[model samples]
Each structure stands twice: as structure tokens, then as C-alpha cells.
Target: MLRTVSYHPVVRALAAHGLHTTVDVSRTYPQRRFTDERDRQYAIAAVRALFGDPAGREENGRFHCLHYESRPESR
Candidate 1:
């Protein structure tokens, strides 16, 4: 568990809201579509990348989960 007490403004803001844990979207329990789906998808992809999920792939040269690669313009 890497906890570096990030100094980045975004991290600080999220920390203020207790959004510290990685937003997991796994093969066993995929994140569901929500009203704020784009945000969730992006967060899930980021969490996958952070945790080194095997299904994470490169899309337009940027790294994200497989679903984001398939549905590139969801946002």
C-alpha cells in the first residue's frame, strides 16, 4: 500500500473528501454505469493502471482499462 501524502492539489481535494482508496473496477466485479459514469470509468481505469491490472491497455497512446479502449469517447 503506497501512501505518499501527495502534495498535488487534486489529491489534496480528494483527501479532504475521504476519497483516498483506489477506485477498483475488476474483472470479477466490474464497475457499473452510473449517472456520473464517465468519472467512474476514468477513476476505475486509473485505479487499474495504478494496481497493474493485466487487462489495462493503451489507447491513442494513453493507458487505460480495456473498456475505455473499446469505448474511447464515453465522456
Candidate 2:
């Protein structure tokens, strides 16, 4: 079963930092939401390079955002 993965704040934050979030980022990693700045930056770069643009929207309330998964990215 798919899990919930809301990475709006992180993706938004990365975009704000001039990092382009991409879609291929979906399940690109073992986990979503990175606490480490370096990891986040790397992930953003990687996803941006592979996916190009990050698409997301708020669902199940303004708090939950669908970053890179239909249901969730697990964890």
C-alpha cells in the first residue's frame, strides 16, 4: 500500500532557495522530507535535473500537500 508524503514546505523552501523541484523525485529516494540541509539541496538538485519542475497541491486540508506521490511517498 502507498503511504502519505507531504513535502510542500520542504519543496517550497527549496524553490525559494532557487532550487527547482522536479516530479521524477517521486520515489527517487528511500524517504521523503529531508532534515539535513545538504541532503535537501542534493535531492532538490537531483530531482530538478531529472524531473525539471516540481508539481504539488494541498489535499486533505491545507496542511497536507501532495509533493511527488498520488497517495504518498511513504514515510
Best by lDDT: 2
Which tens-of-lDDT digit does each residue in 25-48 have in candidate 2?
Answer: 343223345556665555455445
lDDT of each: 0.37, 0.40
Model 2 bad stretches (over 4 Å): 1-31, 55-75
Model 1's C-alpha root-mean-square deviation from the true structure amounts to 14.6
lDDT of 1 by residue, 1-75 (tens): 111112246545656665553433343232333346465456546545555442433212232322211112223
lDDT assessment of candidate 2: 0.40
Q: The CA-based lDDT of model 1 is what?
A: 0.37
Off by over 4 Å in 1: 1-35, 52-75
Model 1: colliding residue pairs: none
Candidate 2: TM-score? 0.29
